[model samples]
Target: MAAIKPKHQRLVLALIALAAILAAGALATWALRNQASYFYVPSEIVANPPDLDRAVRLGGMVEMGSIEMEADGVTIRFVVGDGTARVPVRFKGLAPSLFVEGSGVVAEGKLAKDGTFIADNLLARHDENYVPRELQDMTEHQKDAVISETVGAK
Candidate 1:
């Protein structure tokens, strides 16, 4: 039997390891492709929204005076505002207790064909003090008090 060189054996082993890693990465990516949910702002969705069937996240401030409660009380319609941009949202299920008009929120679900966001999940701060960007300029003491109050109330 011809003797194989040690360096060539090492090179072959390295190549095989690299190939295995690449294969695993590709498989993982393929598995997660359909599970990924993309996040979009109102402006982005207005210009180019993803497929209506695919799940996504829409984050913005709830437009004041645009929120309307249906007679059933379960079907709530409102508009999400990002300053210059806006997107209408319709939620059939119970919204988060913290959700309110003019509050910062993140809605996760799919968009309807008529430009309404059909949200299945909503995340929002119970009070304006809990919203970070709005609390950014507050003093450390003020921030601590807000945190304590929120935590204590909860």
Candidate 2:
């Protein structure tokens, strides 16, 4: 048997390395196939809902007059809406402090057969101009004093 020349040996090694990398990428993708979550808006969800078993994220503004608490108090129901459509979401947990009507929200979970989104997690979004309720009414000077106090204490 003739030994491969250096040039040929290097080429073979490079091809093997590339194959190994591709195999690693394929394995990673396969392993995380179910872990990936797709994002959809209310309009898209209403047009073509996702599979009931597939986890997905639904993002939209929380519609006014649509939030209600269940008898258990922990389960909250709300409607998320885009300008074109709306999706009802049911979440059985403590929502984030910023979660409220008219705010942006991303609910992560699966869609139900009944068309309601069964959320396992809720993420609330606030605008850049957001101010805490306590600070909203404070004057600029008062706000500065409070800020300095908190900073000094920290």
Point to the candidate with the largest TM-score: 2
Local distance difference test, candidate 2? 0.81
- Model 2 agreement with the true structure over 3-75: per-residue lDDT tens digits: 6687798899999999999999998897676433377888788898888998899987788789999999899
TM-score (C-alpha) between model 2 and the true structure: 0.61
**True lDDT of residue 79, candidate 1:** 94
Scored against the true structure, residue 106 in model 1 reaches a CA lDDT of: 85
lDDT of 1 by residue, 1-154 (tens): 2356877888899999999999999988976774343767787789888899988998777876898988997898899866657899988887887687656678899988998999998888445464466565666567546544543443
Query: For candidate 1, what is the TM-score?
Result: 0.58
Candidate 2: segments with Cα more than 4 A from true spot: 1-37, 127-154
RMSD of 2: 10.2
Q: Rate the local accuracy (lDDT) of all candidates.
A: 0.77, 0.81
